[model samples]
Target: MILNFFDQFCIPNLLGVPLIILALFFPLMTWFTTNRLIQNRYSTVQSSFLIYITKQMMLPINITGHKWANTLITLMLMLMLLNTLGLLPYTFTPTTQLSMNMALAMPAWLMTVLTGLRNQPTASLGHLLPEGTPILLIPMLILIETASLLIRPIALGVRLTANLTAGHLLIQLTSTAVLALMNTMTATAMMTLVVLILLSCLEMAVALIQAYVFVLLLTLYLQENI
Candidate 1:
């Protein structure tokens, strides 16, 4: 039963062929593109929304970090699409995989850290310990700070994995219960189905929020470094 419950999260396959690669790029396929002098209504709305989000993300970043705006915006849209698309029946979510999340988080996080160290070595190292540390506490504080710095990527990956996993598990469990109860108790099953519907709605919101939070944290990390 447990394995069956988790099977949905497994990388889906068809005739021994992995579908994850297809899933990864499916979101991009749905996007509208145009080269006309004026975009159509849907294209205009999409462009405006993306621009708004890009501007908001860039607002808190330093001028030096502005160059990353396009990269960050692309990531945000990709993540948003992936998370939302995963909620569809029979679809896989790459972000729910620890390995995949780490692959995404580590490079981005490391790049920000490296950029900081390269551009402002003193400031980056200074973050290891406060300026007013006591002589005896210096080593301990540095160790703690260093450990924290090293764990940011892990934290980012785990946060995304845990939240999506929990929500998916909850939805799965509630849905199974609803189905099982329908044979014996119609009214109770109906109530459970309503709860399941609400949970699905909540999950959609969580999908978008988690994606935004992920990008927002990266932006903040970039801000600190650049």
Candidate 2:
């Protein structure tokens, strides 16, 4: 059973789901606690603003915790670490698979919905419409906004999966080339090994870069969409 699952997931398909779930609320615990402690010790403008926002948000329900934001940051970090780890020489790179990337991106898309729902019920749909849209254009604006919002997550998923998949396939092809060029089978073996190692290192760098890009884009989207 274990071997079967490993064989199935060794190429990066569905593994990101468990990781995303585990990381779902990690940011809140890591971020809010630290922020609270820092504010108690040093009350700065930033700290005050954070506290004020917390208070305003919690006035009705008293949710003094910055749990939502924390959870998101934590989720981002978890994805980054998981993806980077997968870039190891002998390991499977999960993010290289489309199914895995879609699972991860889905939560981000859901968060945008929840953010609007929780914070701005009346004005939520207006996010797509922008401010000061003319009366004549309001209906058209809403339609365009609806289409754009629906498409954001699909683009996010495809971008990540395609990049990872292409990178891995490229490295594999290059390693194959190193093997094909050899006059002696023995020398080809050695060159193939070297190319594999070099590609492994390259993959590691790409892993880090991809993770950073994913999270950075995620944060930017949240900043606006939320």
Most accurate candidate by lDDT: 1
Per-residue CA lDDT of model 1 for 151-183, tens digit only, reads 999999999999998999999999999999999
Candidate 2 local lDDT, 152-174, one digit each (tens): 78888888777666667766666
The candidate 1 region of ten consecutive residues with least summed lDDT is 27-36
Measure candidate 1: CA RMSD: 2.1
The models' CA-based lDDT, in order, is: 0.88, 0.64
Cα lDDT, model 1, residue 14: 81
| Candidate 2: segments with Cα more than 4 A from true spot | 1-69, 184-200
Write down the worst ten-residue block by lDDT for model 2.
1-10
